[model samples]
Target chain A: MSIYLDNGATSYPKPESVYVSIAEYMRNNGASPGRGNYSRAMEADRLVYMTRKALCKLLCVPRPGQIIFTCNATESINMALKGYLKPGDRVLTTSYEHNAVARPLKMLETDREIKIGLIPSTPDGVSDMEWYQQELSKGVRLVVVAHGSNVIGCVTPLDEIVSAAHRHNTPVLVDAAQTAGVYPVDVTSVPVDMLAFTGHKGLLGPTGTGGLYIREGLELSTLKEGGTGGMSLSPFQPSDPPDRYEAGTMNIFGIAGLNAAVQFLLDTGVEVIREHEIELAQFLMDGLDTVPGVTYYGPSSAKDRLGLVSFNLEGQDPNKVAIKLDRDYEIMVRAGIHCAPQAHHLLGTAPGGALRVSLGYFNQREDIERLIDALREITYS
Target chain B: MFLQSINVLDVDLCVQQPDKFVAHTRASADLREIMPYLNSMFRTSTYNHDAGSIKFTNDKIEYTIIGDKINIAKFINRTELHELLDWLKDLVNDTYDSRSEIIPMYVCRKPVPVLFIYNLLPKTNCQQCGEKSCMVFAAQLNKLEIDIEACPILSEPEYTANRRRLEGAFGAFS
Candidate 1:
């Protein structure tokens, strides 16, 4: 089998429970969650509710109702960004955000005349707290930053950023696309106003699964309005939590898969997965250090970043390396700007981009060894 | 010898029109020094400094140069193949003569991948290109399966730069 290393894009070989739950749900109870009151419908509702509960536990969100399911983090972010920002509102974000955050803000900047302040980060991809504080003092309506960069895999200082934003009575929205499952995101402790997460990546769920966690008192207008099973009589959208946000029929199968994946994470513990993934990444980075003509991007050490590394071979296009790796060695890695052009520009790998090797808990040391050997051959052969 | 002989070593065709072909040539000197020159000469060229190779396209013909060996693809006939080789020979000599004036670019000039291209796309996932996502459309573009004109979003003035870059990297719109 090919060695899968594009976990940052979307995790593969999802845990056995994820597949089982998805299949079982499809085979037995394939009813919409809130459409009916039959046994099958009730089962669907229980599944979605349990999925929400699982997410609340994983993300440290206070209430399960606050977890609003979306197609992916992109939709989650769009809901938060488009729903919250009005014309002329000031929004602050970091340089390391994916297009999920960047594109929405870019659109709003033009459509609504919302001012965007980009907080500069260190060379290692950590947000500059002083710059963030300065921006916060200017009284921005909201601050949205990625918890971890998809390109470099570096985790931002979300705690400090959130605390600083709170000091100025500004809300902070965290794009936790990269860190949600791999790292501990204690919303209760961090006081983050909003967080958007995807299930297909670190959470080990199927595709088309992700959600947004809105803080208790904060209200975001609905991005889409349609049939909510309960609010059929009213033409206006509901002013509640989950149903208000989820307009159409939910992706029950995806949520079932996510429920199982979250349970697996809860059972195994996130710290254990984090430690394993970090060890594998460290091994890959250490091996890369010996390869000639190889330049890695992001923080100097693996400890400071997520379980991934981005690098480029001298004179080789990242696509060429990735293609060779797949064709010659049956190894899989992602190569490109990683849907984060701003981040790549910050890492100085624009135009040609860079190759990314993202690690998952299932990745063993042997996988890293094989990757290192392949990279060595590609670089030095 | 300023230029020597070109030979078609092997041709492998999976379908009616061969998607890929391999060839080699004997030259007086190593082609490594002239790679960057070729890269600059071709809009669709990617030069790998570490591997000492350059891949570029002339019209519809894609060429990969390593030392004196050349692998080419997507030729309709022998005449087209010979014409491409002759053009390459001239490019090599011209670049060699003008080496003093030319600055060698060691960076890979490859087209940005589908994801990067997709980022620049409208990303409405509107499926106007007959594909589900803009990412899929970008992938087809990379494979030369489709052209930028197929994307309705490119017609918009807002995406003029993206259209230009795509045209530059892939070649003039088909």
Candidate 2:
């Protein structure tokens, strides 16, 4: 079996429950939900509804329907960005946004004539809230910030940022692609307009399933108008929480798997999972620091970041190191741009970025040692 | 209603009003079935399917056909673009490949032609992956975004000097 380390991309060896539950759903209650009145269809609807409720409990959203599903966090982000912004509306975002968020905003910058102001993050990937407050003073309509940077894994001050945005009457859109399941996102207490997330990343769901939590009554122009099963009779799309934004048949299998995944998190308890992953990250961080010629990024302490690390070896091409780790060592790691060029640029890993070793709960101390041992050999040789 | 204009095999489909275009679902097979009718709408000559891209110069739109599975067509005028999107959606339902969804064709302005940059050195640079000229290999590599593993020569220590310099020239993380 491949030593899978790309948890930042998608978690592997997903809970057996995830696979079994999806199969169970497809085998027993496979049908277009909300379109039919049959028992199987109702069962499918119940499964989807339970999934939403599970996500709500995980994110602390009071209402379940406010959670809208999409193919991935990128699509959810695109929906939030495109739906909310009107021409000339000023959106304040941080420099640390993923290409998923940055690319859509850039497209809008070029074509839609929307004004984008960036709140530059510090070297450790924390946004300069003073800069954000300054932008808010300049009439910022929406403030989009990542709960954590995917490249460096630095967790931002979400509570403070959300509180600040609320003062300006600007609703913040938190891109929780990295932090959703690993970190506690209590939407009930934290003031945010929307929390865009992916099920595949920390949530441990299959790929091609993700979603957004739009605060009730927040309006967005529907990115795609389609048949949302329930309101098939209407000419215009239904103006409801999920159906308003979620247009089309959902990724049923992926969602069923995701429901199981989220259920796994609840059963295990996120606090325990978070504590374990953080400890593992700390273990790896401490191990990586002892190696000579190794330059790491993100907060020096593991307390400030997520379960991922980005570092580079002296006089080593990240790609070469990645190849060596994969082929010779059987250790899998990501090399090159982690899709957040601006963050790397800020961290001075620009142009040629660092090798990223993102750890998950399933990762053990022995795995960390193997990585450490491999780095020693790769760096020395 | 989620179907939109899809440019397929050199065809502009479902031309309609700006706001009415629908998003195409991956399930739709009808979009893939009308390729013959869609291909007939082409105004260009160089129908090089192997090049992996279809060019529509008059309208400044390029539809890069990613393999036989996915077709991403560009629309220049944002107005009535939905109509074209709708047509494309119909074709996608008809012609889509079974195994893959093919990367969605994103509408972009800059012609980021994947040009390969190689070390312009005359030295044999003969580090083994077999090609006599590193420049030719770079050109071929640039033309096709293949994995660096395919280029056998880069594995050698002799080409080490050129590989470092060459990867820097072609910036998106060599």
Candidate 3:
């Protein structure tokens, strides 16, 4: 079988339960939730509700209604950005943000006259706390950051960032797109103002599924307004939590798959998954040490990062390396800027991106061995 | 209309289909003028004006344009390659000849952007069209995978202007 290692973009070979649940939902109850009173519709609503609750539990969120289902983390980030910021709002973000956060912020910079200050980050992908504090002291309205860098797989110190923002009375928005399902994120203890997540990556759900969790009493203006299967005659958007934010029909099919994936995570345990992934990543890194002319990015230790490694062979384009990996070794990996131009710029991997091999719970030690073996061959051959 | 040269610069394994090949070709001629018309004619064609590229499938062979180069993917053998080149030549010439009759569309006529299409649609997000949301329905419409008439709200008199725009944009593809 081919080795699938591009889990950062989207996890492949999802748990059997996720696939089975999606098919069963499509076949048995494909009705739109909250739109009808029929049995199938109610079942759809129940499934969606269960999925929300599972997400809340997984993220340590207090309320299920606070979680709004979105198409993907990009949509969730857009909603958070557009909904929260007003004209002339000063925002502080890190250098390691994905395009999801950067593009929306850039648009708001023009449309709302918001000022954005990017906190300089270290080469290891950690936010420079001194610079962040200096920026925060200058009185910013909001602070947004990515919990993990998708390019280098480095996990930022969210606790410090959140506390720093909270001390300044500025709310923090955490883009947990890379860390949500792979790492243990306790929002209850962290006290982030908002957290956005995607289900397709480490969560092992299908594409077109993701969510945003808003903290209690933090009101964001609705980004979209439509029928929420309630207050149809009111001619105004609902004033409730989820209904107010979720203005469109939910993706019940994707939610069904996500629910099963979350259930699998709960059963298998997040720590267990994290350990397995870290082990694989450590193995890959250790093996890479023996391979000459191969330079890797991210934290030196696997303990400081997620389950992925970004590297490039000497004088080889990342795309070419990835293509060779796929064609010759049947190993799939992601190349290019990975939608994080700022991070690439910070890492000095710009103009040519690095090849990324992201690990998952499903990955084994042999996969890393095969990848290292192939890289050694490529480097010498 | 004869070409000076068509050189296969590279052959890479196809991502979607592993067994198939993606041959990148460097052509001597600029193929921009015929792109929009081809987008209009082919149901599978998706053109991005901003990117100045068109992606389409003809005779089960996927062709993607980037500047003057073409990446013909998912082809089996030399026969398919010859057939695709001849077909492309004929299409380019035919489109050039009938330029007056065809409106050179810059955006994708087959699969228009869902958000752009959604703006013209009734923002109801009603599931009457058997789609979860009008956005999803718009995506389906752009792919020419679903009928615009499937949406019952579009038939209403209030949405006549929007329907007209949608029809003007996608009706020919249908």
lDDT of 1 by residue, A1-381 (tens): 689999999998899999999999999889987676465765576578778878888988876778899999999999999999999999998887898999999999899999999888765886777777887787799999899889877888777888888889999999999998998889999989999999999999999999999998899988999986653555777677777788898899999999999999999999998988778778888999988888998887778889999999899999999999999999999999888998888888898899999989888999888988888888776
For candidate 2, lDDT tens digit of each residue in A202-301? Answer: 8989999999999977888889999865434459886656777777888889999999999999988888878887888889888988889888888877
Clashing pairs in 3: B111-B142
lDDT tens digits by residue: candidate 3, B1-174: 534445455555567875455767766777776788777777778788777788987666888886689889886432234346545767767777888899777776545678878998887887999989888888887766677799888899999999998887765563
* lDDT by candidate, in order shown: 0.82, 0.72, 0.84
Task: Return whichever of 1 and 3 wins on lDDT.
Answer: 3
lDDT of 3 by residue, A1-381 (tens): 799999999998899999999999999878997776465765576578778888888999987778889999999999999999999999998887899999999999999999999887787886778888988888999999899999878897888998988898999999999898889999999899999999999888999999999998999999999987654656878666777888888888999999999999988989999988878888999998999988888898898899988888888888998999999999999999999998889888997989999998888998888989999999888
Q: Per model, how much of the real contact set is kept? A: 0.00, 0.00, 0.00
TM-score for all predictions?
0.68, 0.68, 0.68
Q: For model 2 chain A, where is the 10-residue window of minimal lDDT?
A: A34-43
Stretches off by above 4 angstroms in model 1 are B1-174
True contacts kept of 2: 0.00
Docking quality level of the chain pair in candidate 3? incorrect
